[model samples]
Target: MPKVISNTSPILYLYRIGGIQWFSKLFDEVWVPEAVKNELRAGKIQGYDVPNPADYSWITIVNPKSMPSEWLALDLGIGEIAAMAGN
Candidate 1:
């Protein structure tokens, strides 16, 4: 089993279609940043019907300290920043 760090979009899409189980089968665990978790929660509130990412036991959410200033300078969304920097 392999461990993988994941971004928001892929997780969102997979959860939207109810395929989140694939992560468990493929990897020992899939790590996500707090930002990604927030994104999913927001999407659900916005009526996107996204599944709760936390419901998946294989998905671990992390809060990384000190994101790269360069990535932050890119003015990307929190999810993107977290994905690149959290890793």
Candidate 2:
């Protein structure tokens, strides 16, 4: 299925600011990666706040087919990679 491939920036930003519902309103489902999850945890451990959105259910994490490490490899980054793979 063609879905949004979300990342850490938008999730954390929205969460901390308590704007998660808006994310749900904008996309059918918001997705993240393990890398992004790890980053979130690291922020929490470092005493950096996280956006909880405890009641929000639209956000999720998915590991797609492997991708190259460097963003430069793909002009549009991994979201583009996953979108391409969907076809």
Candidate 3:
């Protein structure tokens, strides 16, 4: 089983430092919240980052499901919550 909880900042920061390979080496897979993926793909023409196909492999991109919330609140855009609450 892979670690299904990852935040956008660590992912992005690792990408910037060319350590995404390290992440792949450590974990069989990673999880990205919809909000996190949105943050990753936010800018147009952002060019290739470290996690790009050319740089690393085995890191699959996925849109993790949202949690159940009765009360309408500001979304924090998290991954652990996604993995815990998701299928």
Q: On a 0 to 1 TM-score scale, where does candidate 2 land against the true structure?
A: 0.66
Error of 2 at 78 (Å): 10
TM-score of 3: 0.59
lDDT of 3 by residue, 5-81 (tens): 56666777877886766676777776555555555665324664524332345645565455667322545555434
lDDT (0 to 1) per candidate: 0.82, 0.61, 0.56
TM-score of each: 0.87, 0.66, 0.59
Cα RMSD of predicted structure 1: 1.5
lDDT of 3 at 83: 40
Best by lDDT: 1
Question: Residues 17-87, candidate 2, lDDT per residue (tens digit)?
Answer: 87767777777766666555666677788998875423357767666666645644766644445433422
Output the worst ten-in-a-row residue range by lDDT, candidate 1.
66-75
Flag regions of model 2 displaced more than 4 Å.
52-55, 69-87
Name the regions of candidate 3 deviating beyond 4 angstroms.
44-56, 70-75, 78-86
Better of 1 and 2 by TM-score: 1
